[model samples]
Target: MKLLLRLATSLLLWIIMMVILVLIILLPRDMEVKRIGVKDHMSYHFTWSGYKENIQQYLADVKENKTLGTSVAHQPVEWELAHYGKRSIAILVPALIISFLIGILKGVFDYRRNRGLWKVLGEGTTWLGQSIPDFFIIIILELIISLTIHRMFPHLQLYGIEHWYNIFLPILFLSMYPAAVIANYTTQALKEEDDQDYIRTARAKGLPETIILWKHVLRNCWSKILIHFMPIILTLLSSMVIVEYMTLYRGMGTRLMEAIKIKDTIASTDTILPIETPTVIGFSLEFMIILLLAQWVNQVIKHFLIPVRKDEHT
Candidate 1:
């Protein structure tokens, strides 16, 4: 019931945000372009009729499968949605899975080893990874791969998602920061769990360190780990814009940029009204759903991990 309420609230919030975004986009802007035999002409107005007309036209285009007639491209909004939706999923799913696994494994290793070169390298790498901006990482990695590896293997293109291998670099770029964040939190959570009385009791019982850490400590630390997951997801979502743009992946982020650039133009001049509304709404929905899912997952994990106490009845 609570989850349902939360979901409803999130959906409502997303709708509100989308409405505001659309209004901002639809609001007229003062044009400063020089017209022959005319002084500066500033025209800016907000009208309900315009907003309604725009919405109706967008819906009509979608229903009739009509091309949006964008200044740069003549493609139906449906095609754009389907194409970018698939690419976004392709990038998001694999990057998330790989990052989560790497983070958990790195966290476990960091907790187990007291002193070693592996620890030194892992700590240094994660710290560096967390500190650097994702775009810089993407640029540096692209340069290194293009110069050295691509010379030996010309099949791998530096930009554009032409093949399956093309996604590798972008995914790596997206995953690095989140993975490092997760690993850092995981290590801290486990270290804190290590000093708890339950851990001490397990150690005193002569249980193997591996079993105790994995079966007991790690199980207890899941709730704590999940608490930090939402921020990691938000980070990944934001980073996708840069990564997709840099790699020319033709995803939602790229579409969003195009939409923003042409938001103020007239439909006759640039017919992106249909494309802009759906793109903005689609991205907003995706973001809200992911956020809600993260919250739900965290709540489920926390509920399961928490101890349920029985009340004594006289």
Candidate 2:
């Protein structure tokens, strides 16, 4: 009953959040005609009202072998949809899963061994990650990287993001914040679970350390870690804006920034499209799927922690 109530509460909060996201995205931007072109080249005027029409015009011009001042219209409808959809999942969803799994596993182990220091480390690490802004970390890392590169190869100047090293630094920095938060919460929850009377009872039974750690400590601490991860995923999604802006990576973050800068309504709307639906389904099916998985995990843990009795027990 408690689990169900918690699930219901989580669902309600998710719905509220989705509604807010929808309102922010759907509110029409002020339309204005602006010239858009590549690399500070010649351009043509288009407004939000005529966005589709302009795309069509560009496509038609290309089909008829016409050029608008060195620009050829190649509307990337299929590419944009496919790319953005894949990227939204690739960046946010997988990161959440990885962080939760690794954090929970290591955290439970650490808590079982070092109850005293784990508390301080867990809380302190999370607080440090949360209190410091992500951009500040990014800038500091960027400066360090810049100095290193200049020292090693003075002739080499990094411009485009074609280099593998260029891509990794930003992703690593952005990911650090969430990973720290997950580890912190996981450790704290496990420490708390370790102090429970049930754990003491299990220990009194002379269970091996490994068995107690996995079956008792981890199983009980999981739900708390999961709950922490849910909001961190949301925070990471929000932080993508800053991360992409700073790193200049061509992910959804960068795409969203580009739309805002150019005032491209279609692109901006497309970028903000929820993982599941944009205008059709009111509920976020993508987020709903995640919520369901979290609930299923909770049920599995509960069942394991408290076994049901058979009729023979009577």
> Candidate 1 residues 1-314, lDDT tens each?
76567667766776687567655554434233333464443344556787677677765765675543233355555566667778887888888888888898888877776477877877777778789887888888888888898899787675787777777777888888888888888888888765777777889999999898888888777777777666777888888889899888878778777765544544342233333445555555555666667766665654555442111110
Give Cα distance to truth, residue 247, candidate 1, Å.
Answer: 2.0
Question: lDDT tens digits, residues 1-314, model 2?
Answer: 77677667766776786656544443433333334553222234435655555345544654775422120124343344346445545556655665666566556545554547775564555667668887887788879878898789986644335574554544565577787677778778766665667667778999887887787667666566655544675666777667766766566555544433432233331232222212112223344545556655555555444443112122
Q: Identify the leading candidate in terms of lDDT.
A: 1
Predictions in order: lDDT: 0.70, 0.56
Give the lDDT of residue 281 in candidate 1: 53
Which regions of candidate 2 deviate over 4 angstroms?
A: 1-73, 84-89, 105-122, 153-167, 208-211, 262-314
TM-score, prediction 1: 0.79
| Each model's Cα RMSD | 4.8, 10.0
At residue 32, what lDDT does model 1 achieve? 35
Each candidate's TM vs. the true structure? Answer: 0.79, 0.57
